[model samples]
Target chain A: MVLIYIDHSEKEIKKSSHEAISYGAAIAKQLGCSAEALLLGTVNDDLTALGKLGASKVHQLNNESLNNFDAKVHASLIATAATNLNAEVIVFAHNINGKAIAPAVAVKLDAGIVTGACSLPDLQNGFEVTKTVFSGKAFAHIKIETPKKVIAINQNSFGIQNFEASATVVEMTLPIPAASVKVTNVNKIIGEIPLTEANLVVSGGRGLKGPENWGILLDLAKALGAATACSRPVSDSDWRPHHEHVGQTGIQIAPNLYIAIGISGAIQHLAGVNRSKTIVVINKDPEAPFFKAADYGVVGDAFEVVPALTAAISKMKHNE
Target chain B: MNILVCISKTPDTTAKIAFTEGNTKFDENGVQWIINPYDEWYSLVRAIEIKEKDPTTNIHLITVGGPEAEPIIRKALALGGDEAIRVNSNSNDSYVIAQQIAAIAKQGSYDLIMTGKETIDYNSACIGSMLSAILDLPYVSLANHLEVNGNTASVQREIEGGEETNEVILPMIISCQKGMAEQRIPNMRGIMAARTKPLKVVEPLATNAHTSIKEFSLPPSKTGVKLIAPDQMDELVKLLKEEAKVI
Candidate 1:
């Protein structure tokens, strides 16, 4: 059986996992096998709704203890689940949680692993897989010779292809190990899209001048319904929270579109966001390093250009 | 309380990457190695925080690499660790590296294991989770903030679209990222004291091998930027519609 690991937050399915499930179901179809799903933790949505994504069955370990992600415990339980189902191919969404647990599961199963995979495995040619290397700069084709294989599919690589089918929901009991890591209290800042998963992002830098001017950037981001990010200096200067920083020293992101206003791209900064599919730079400095990497560059004041762009986008959306 | 933080020696972020003669290994010549930045947050800073919370805490830095990795190990020691350990091995496979760490953690019977979410060199955030699996412990990844009280820890991790906070029990592994703690530089006195600290060097135990890298290559450089005239908004729109198709 081919197994897909469904990643969810607050019982709602993640966009990335939809792609993974589609990818897994496609692979299983190609192999002339059945596609199944394994969901860890509690989910609020209907389990059978997963059938729309491609899974024929949903194996749920609904223990509330599994709801909070503990990578070690997750890996152990996943390894056991894979063994129980006699899974030949294991698929995961190449997000933060998948990056942590997939390799560990591969180790437990003694299976060959491929991470950051951007395409379906070429099953006709020795089960070859392609993955992003150099921080999403290039692709490397790898083949796993081990009988059991693990693939962590990159986000946005595969489009979601939903099919109408009724999926049987099976509740299975697996040994839950005692957690070594204790959780005392949770402190979270609510009400902002995470930079990693945002489809559109608007980021700023020192050019914004000070923290007070941050509202302008936030305005543009809000207009586009995009996530807000900052250069390392902005965060270092306390203009933005450290989590909002995106660079080699900060969070590396690969989004559909990344727009920068008033930020000069350093090599470190580029390394983190270079994976973005499309880059748009609006900086007054014509010689800013960021312009060299941008697919579109406007050598004009961000104050002038951003408002115009925002207005144009809003107008286009309204017309649509 | 005894704490063990596993550190990895990695090429500095600024170093130019190159492959060996046969494209088999990452070229290390003339490359500067630093204590992996992620490890610095999850391991060293957290260890110091524990020591500050209780002055009796003993924190040790450990790495699985050759003698050449000592200076980087010493740098981590200077930051806050009480001592250091260098396992004589150089392997890129995550499983092998985790095996060495699990062996050390088991032998030391340490209460806590901390490491970076992923080493920047390979961008593989596997070791901590793999070690956790091997050691039969709970693990947290991408912890942007962490705090401990007694045997419980409250950690916040970056999730898709937002952040999630969890309360976990101790004797677990936590892979840290930014927002966990600010990076700290060793003081002059700490640097001087690090030179005298004890560093134990030992041979790595047998490793369970799994996979290998076939080759390494650089990414294709992005094309030069296309300049769109500020006043020619119509032309820019036409270009985006016809040429880029990103809009």
Candidate 2:
């Protein structure tokens, strides 16, 4: 059996989990096995609806403590579930949570684990999985020699596909481990589209000049319904919150469209956002390194060009 | 207080990646190795800061690699680590590396264990959490800020949209990221001190790697950029609308 770990936050299922389910389902189909999902905590989404993405069954351990992520506890629970099901392959979305727990689970099960997997395993001769290495600059094909295997798919690498199926949901009663950490306070920005989940992202760098000039970027982001991000230098300069920084040293996002304004595409910065489907760079410097990676490039001043683009988008929306 | 920082040696960011032996092995020729930026900049520096705050604290560096990795470990010591431990094994498998670190950590009874969020080379982001499981300690990954008070540590980590603050007790594991601490440069005086620092090489515990690399290949290079003049803003918008369809 192929088991997929469904990652959820605050009862809402994450977008990456859907992709993982589809990827796991495809793997199961390729291996001639059944695809199942494991949910550790209570989730609001209908488990049956998840079946459309391709799981035959959903095993849920509805424990309140499980809602808060503890790497040790989650690893133990998932390891138990994988063992109980006699899973040949286990899948996880290589998000923050999955990256934390997958290796521990791999250690517990003695499974050959591959994280940041970009493509499905080739089962023709041996189980070879291709994964991103060198911070997205290269790919390495890894082969697992162990009987049990664990694979964590990178976000946005595999698009989600839906099929016609109804998955049976089963509640599981397993021993829960004590959490080693406690939540003192959570300062979460409510109602903003997360960078990881956003299909469109508008990011800026020091080219915006200061925090006061951020209105133009916000206008463009609001008009496009996109999340806002910044370069590492911008965050370091305190022009934007550190959470908004997207680079090798910051949050890595794989949005469908990444619009970068005034940011010189440093190699470290490119390491984070290079996975975006379409890169649009707006910079006054024609020789900016980011232009080399952009799908579409516009050589212009951000102060003038961003406002014009925002106005044009607003007008386009008005016409609609 | 004893603090343990896990260090890794990785190729520099600008190093041209190439494979040898029918693309089955990483070509190490003409490659420059440095302490992984994440390890040196965040994890090791933060541990040093903690030691600075408490004069009684001792910071130790550890790595799982062959003799070539000793220079990287010594560089870490120059940045204020008290001692170094080298587990003599060179394996790309994260599980094996974690087991080795966990075994050493168990013997040391460290109050705090730290590592970078992930190495730039392999980018597994797994060693710290795996060590936590093996040691059965609290684990926090990608911690941006950390504050320790007595037995409890308050850590702020980035989530999707915002940040989550966690308070974990001592004997815990944390994977450091940016904002945890500032990067420190080693001075000549520190370099001299590092040369005298104790770097004990030990044999690794018997642990088998579960995974092996079949081959390596670089991502296809990007095609040359298509530039549109500033006056051709509408043309760019039209292309985005009709050609790319991302908007």
What's the TM-score of chain A alone for every prediction? Answer: 0.94, 0.97
Worst 10-residue lDDT window for candidate 1 chain B reads B232-241
Candidate 2 wrongly placed segments (more than 4 Å): none
lDDT of 1 by residue, B1-247 (tens): 7889889987787777777867657778898888888888555787798798898889988999998898987788788899998888987767788888888788886767888877777776778878776887777788777777787777777776556777777777888888777789989888888999999988888865565666565666768788876665556545654676655
Give each model's whole-structure lDDT. Answer: 0.81, 0.90
Q: Model 1 over residues A1-320: C-alpha lDDT tens digits?
A: 89999887667778788889899999999889999999988888888988988999999998887776667778888999999999999999989889879988998888877877877887775787877665554456666768899889887777789798868999989879876444444444568887877878899988888999878788778877889999999999999988889987688887777888889988888878888888888889999999888988899977777777766666665766
Q: Write the per-residue lDDT of candidate 2 for residues A223-264, one digit (tens) a residue.
A: 989999999999998999878899887888889899999999
Worst lDDT run of 10 residues, candidate 1 chain A, spans: A180-189
Best by TM-score: 2
Query: What is candidate 2's CAPRI-style docking category based on DockQ?
Result: medium
Highest-DockQ candidate: 2
